[model samples]
Structure formats: structure tokens, C-alpha cells
Target: MKALVVYESMFGNTQQIAQAVAAGLGKHVEVEVTEVGLAPDEISAELDLLVVGAPTHAFGMSRASTRADAVKQAPGGTIVSTGRGVREWLEAVHPGGVGTMVAAFDTRVRAPLPGSAAHKVAKALQRLSFPEVSDPETFWVKDSTGPLKDGELERAERWGADLGLLVNSR
Candidate 1:
């Protein structure tokens, strides 16, 4: 079995969660984790699963303006993903087939939010005809440019493991 985890991060919190998720999936199958900027525009038919993730901006997926604003937040600091995010990348992605089971995840502030990047990603994946393996998930962060909330990465890993087993059973 094989899976691809493509993620977009602004302050590296999402990247860390993606890596943790991939680590759990790795136990059940070969898994590749890549940033959205470096992710392929076309998902391979050979993949049994595709996991997409990003950091929520303005309550949903990041747009060019949101990304630019994020850069503004980081003044002289380093930003993990400086280019296109999940929203832009998904706009041009071509899935190999609808047979591939898919899942979505996102990182957002712990505070109550009206939207989610994961929700947006799940809807987009449905539009592309990817088979939905599970409901979207959210990992919380302490703040906008955040270190993820304690235990969120662990939760992501557990979610990934469950997703792996769920897909394998099908």
C-alpha cells in the first residue's frame, strides 16, 4: 500500500503535524510527505491514499492575500511554506482516479472558528471525485503563527493510523 501526504505550512506547525501523520501511516504502508509547493500536480494511480493538509487562514484555506499577510507576520523570521498553499495547488491538481481513498486535515487556532481548511479541502477532493475515506480533521494551534497545541501532533498521528487501517480494510 502507498500514501502521499501533501501539506502547506506557514510557521512549520502544519509541516510537523504532516510528518507525524505520515509516521503513523508509514507503519502500514509506504508514505511520502511533501510540502504543497513541492507536491506533484498529478496524483499517481499507484497510490492507495492521498492526504491533503494546510494551515487555516481567515478561518479557511489560505489565499494569496492570506499568505502574504502571513509573511508580514514573520518580519525577519523564517516561513516554512512561502509559495502556493493548498487552495492554489488544489485548483490545478489532477487526481489519477476516483479509486484512491482520500482524507483532509488542517491546523487552526484552538479558538472557535467559523471555517476550516480541512473542510475546504474535503469539499474540493469530492469535486475531483476522490473517494472519501474519512471526515476531515483539525489540529489546533495556540495562535496564528503558532507552535501547535500540545498533543495535536500526537492526535494527528493517531488519526493517520486510523485512516491507514480504514483504507486497508476496504
Candidate 2:
């Protein structure tokens, strides 16, 4: 099986998780991981699984304004000013069909929050009729600019492995 893991990260925590998740999926299938800005405009028909992740901003997906604000606040992170984030990417992608299994994940502060970029991405995928292979998952961060809470990368890898199993079962 072929799997793609696309992610948007500001401070690199989410990028790390995306890499770890791809590593896990690699155990069961060929996988490619890319930043959301560099992701293709459409999901390839040959892909069996599509995993998308991002850093949660303002309790949800980060918008251009939010990302800009984050840059202003943090001053020195790899925040992309000219690239499309996962939210914009998701909005623009037209998946071929419902055959591709989809999963979503996000990095967020470990708070009792009501929103997540992962959940919103999952909802968008659902609207496009893609079957969800896993529920939206959250990897915790300690703060806005974060070193992910310890062990979160391990957890993300495990989630990816589980998602691979789910896809293989189909």
C-alpha cells in the first residue's frame, strides 16, 4: 500500500510527529511525508491512505492571519508566510473517490479544548466522501511554541501503525 502523510508545522513539533507517523506507516506500506505546502493538489489514485496533520491554533486549524500572528508572537520559527497550510490544502484538494482511507492528527496545548485541526480536517474529508480509517487524534504540546509533551512522537507513531493496520484490513 502507498500512504501519504502531509503536515503543516510552525515550530517544528508537528513536523516531527508527522515524520514519526510516516515512520510507523512505513512498517506496513510505502509512505511519503511532506509539508502541506508541498503536497500535491490532488490525492493520487494509487494511494491507499492519506494522513494529514497540523498545529492547532486558536483551538482549531490555523489560518493565514493566525499564522501571521503566530510569527509576530514567536519572532523566529519556520513559519511559512507564502505557503498554503493544511486547512487551505484540504479545502482545495479534490480526492478521486471514497476509496482512499483518511486519518487526521494535530498538535495542540493539552487543554480541555473543544476544537482541533484534526477534527476539522476529518469533517472536510467526510464531506468529500472519503472513508475515515481512524478518529481524529491529538498530540499534546506544552504551549504555543512547544517541544511536544514528552512521548507524543511515540504515541503518534503508534497511531500511524494502527492506521496502517486499519487500511490493510480493507
Candidate 3:
């Protein structure tokens, strides 16, 4: 089985979690990690699973205006996902998922936010005909530009491993 982990990050926290998740997935199947800017626009039949993730902005997935706002607040002026966000990538991806297992995840501050990037992504993927393989996941961050809450990376890795195992089993 092969899995692609695609992600968008404003600061570095989401990317770090994506890498950790990929590392865990690599243990159970062939896995590739890429930023949403460079992610493929089509999912081929050969790809067995797709994992999409992004940092929640203003509640849900980042929009152009939200992304611009994030860029302005980027720590050290270092924006990890300067080019594209998961929203744009999803918009442009081909509508097909006949044999593909899909999952969504997000990074956000541990607050009572009203929306979720993962949920939005999952809904979009479902609209594209992808069968969800798992419930949407959320990894907590400390602040806007975050140092992810302690052990969040480890938790994400475990979640990835479990996801990989689930797909491999099926």
C-alpha cells in the first residue's frame, strides 16, 4: 500500500507534524510527504490512500485572505506554505476516489474555536467522492504561530501509524 501525506503550513508546526505522521506511516507502507503547493492535482488509481492536512486559520481551512493574514503574522517572517493552501489544492484536484482511502487532519490552538480545517477538508473530499478512512484528526498548537502543544507530534505519529495499519488491513 502507498500513502501520500499532503499538508499546508503557515508557521512550521503543521509541517513538523506532517513529517512525523509520514515517518510513522512509512513504517507500515510506502509514504510520501509534500507541501500542498507541490502536491499533485490528481489522485491516480495506484495511490492507495490520501492524507490531507493544514493549519486551521480563523477557524477552518485557510483562504487567500486568511493565508495573507497568516503570512503577515508569520514568525521571523518565515512562512512554510507561502504558495498554496489545502483549500486551493482541493479545489483543483480531479474529482475521483473510487479506490482511494482518504483522511483529513488539522493543526490549531487548543481553544474553543468554532470551526475545523479537518472537517472542512473532509467534507470537500467527500464531495469529491472519496470514502473517508478515518475520523478527522486535530493536533493542538500553543498559539497562532505555534510550538505545538507538548507531545502533539508523538500523538500525530501514533495516529498516522494507526491509520496506515487500518488501510493496510483492508
Candidate 4:
């Protein structure tokens, strides 16, 4: 089955998790992974699964205000960091019931945990009518810029494997 994994990353931690998930999915089925902004219309209903990811910022998904501020302050919105790309990409998906299974994942600092990006993404997927929505996955980071504590990547791999099984069986 064809699958796609798309992610938004800051400090590259979420990107690493996206890669690990893609590698795990690659072991069992064909998969393509890309930064959320780089994804093209190649995604279609024929795709069996889609995984979306982002890094949690300021207790919520990144805001357009932040993006707007960055654009104003910097030439290309380079300085403002956000997880909004996943939401933006979701909006861009071909809209009338694409029939693809979807799952979401997010990376966040462990302390002062306000909420999760994965949960937010999952809810959004439900709104979009993704056929079967899986539980959101979360990975922990010790500092704002993280090395991912320990075993986080391995856990992400395991989640990917499990996700593959769930989608295949359905």
C-alpha cells in the first residue's frame, strides 16, 4: 500500500521522529516521507495511509499571528517557528472524502505540558473525515531544543510498525 508521512519540525527533533516512523513503515509497506511544506498533490485516495506530525509550540499548534509577525519582521517568515504547516497541508488535501486512513504524531517539551500537537491534529483529521483515525502519538523532549531524551526514536519506530498493522488489517 502507498503511504505518506509528513511533518513540521523545529530544531529537527520532529523531523527525526518522522524519519524513524517512515523507516519503520518502509519495512512493511511502501512509504513516502516529506516535510509538510514540500508535499505535493501526489497524495490521493489510493494512498492507504497518511501520517502527519508537528512540534508543539506554546501549548497549542503554532498560530498564524506568529507566522504573520515573522513575515513582518523577517524577509521570508524565517524567524517564527511553528507547527502550522500540518494544519495548512491538511487544508490543502483534496477535500471531498479522500478515503485515506490518517494518524498524527507530535514532539513536545515534557515540562509545563500545556497540551499536545498530536491530539490537535487528530481532532482536525476527524473533522476532515479521514476514514480511520488512530490515536495521536507523542514524543518527549527534555529541553526546548531537544536530543529526545532516550528511546524516543525507538518508540516512534514501534508506533509506526503498529500503525502499519492497524491500517493493513482495516
- TM-score: model 2 vs. ground truth: 0.94
lDDT at 55, model 3: 90
Q: Comparing candidate 3 with candidate 4, which one achieves the higher TM-score?
A: 3
- The whole-model lDDT of each prediction reads 0.90, 0.87, 0.91, 0.77
RMSD of 1: 1.1
Sliding window of 10 residues with minimal summed lDDT for model 4: 74-83
| TM-score list, all predictions | 0.96, 0.94, 0.97, 0.84
Candidates in descending lDDT order: 3, 1, 2, 4
User: Which residues of candidate 1, in runs, are more than 4 Å off?
Assistant: 75-77
Q: Which digits, one per residue and each the tens of the lDDT, describe model 2 over residues 77-168?
A: 45642488988988899987559989999999877767899999899889888889999999999888888999998998898898888888
TM-score-based ranking, best first?
3, 1, 2, 4
How far residue 165's Cα lies from its native spot in candidate 4, in Å, is 1.3
Candidate 3 structure quality by residue, lDDT tens digits, 39-107: 999888888889999999888999999988887887676798989799999999984448798999999
* TM-score: model 1 vs. ground truth: 0.96
Residue-level lDDT of model 1, residues 29-108, one tens digit each, is 88999999999999889999999999888978999898888888974856889888899899999987658889999999
Clashing pairs in 4: none
